[model samples]
Target: MRPGERAVLLGPGEIGEPTVDDWAAWSDTLPHEVVTGLGARLHRHLRPAATTTLRSL
Candidate 1:
């Protein structure tokens, strides 16, 4: 949203060291356009759900 700002993609594994193959396989299943769209809207998609006492991990 600002100049020089950047985004990082991490997941499919633990905090310290995330696995790469899992994410690669999953991405391969989706179209390039869809993946690009998700990258742009990643914040909205990862937002916490409302009305939750303690949501499942």
Candidate 2:
């Protein structure tokens, strides 16, 4: 590990968008202390696509 560097795990979702369950499962595999320290902000960069009203309209 390097200074100011964090570890990231790519989830099974397309484009790496981890669902709530996926995130929970991944966190469950890690040590309690590690998960606690990292907090919810972990992997915050990944996001699901937003919906638009005009889609399929």
Candidate 3:
């Protein structure tokens, strides 16, 4: 991997939710920028005219 390169992973679909405290604890350990960036990038990639994701950025 190199700078500006992203690695995406797909998780299982049948997962259960955690308790409020557990969810809070887990979320506290994450990087907000990374989470939001991935979401924004995915949204761009899914746009109706997004034929080539390479330029989605």
Number of colliding residue pairs in model 3: 0
TM-score of each: 0.22, 0.24, 0.20
Comparing 2 with 3 on TM-score, the higher-scoring candidate is 2
Candidate structures ordered by TM-score, highest first: 2, 1, 3
TM-score of 2: 0.24
Worst 10 residues of 3 by lDDT: 8-17
The sequence of per-residue lDDT tens digits that candidate 3 reaches over residues 1-57 is 998774333222124434333433566744443345445446333224334335331
What is the overall TM-score of model 1 with all chains considered together?
A: 0.22
For candidate 1, write residues 1-57 as lDDT tens digits.
Answer: 687575445443444433344455676653444445555535642545354466354
* CA deviation > 4 Å runs, candidate 1: 1-12, 15-20, 29-37, 44-57
Which lDDT values do the candidates have, in the order given?
A: 0.48, 0.55, 0.40
How large is the C-alpha RMSD of every model relative to the true structure?
A: 12.9, 8.5, 11.8
Return the top candidate by TM-score. 2
Q: Which prediction has more favorable TM-score, 1 or 3?
A: 1
Better of 1 and 2 by lDDT: 2
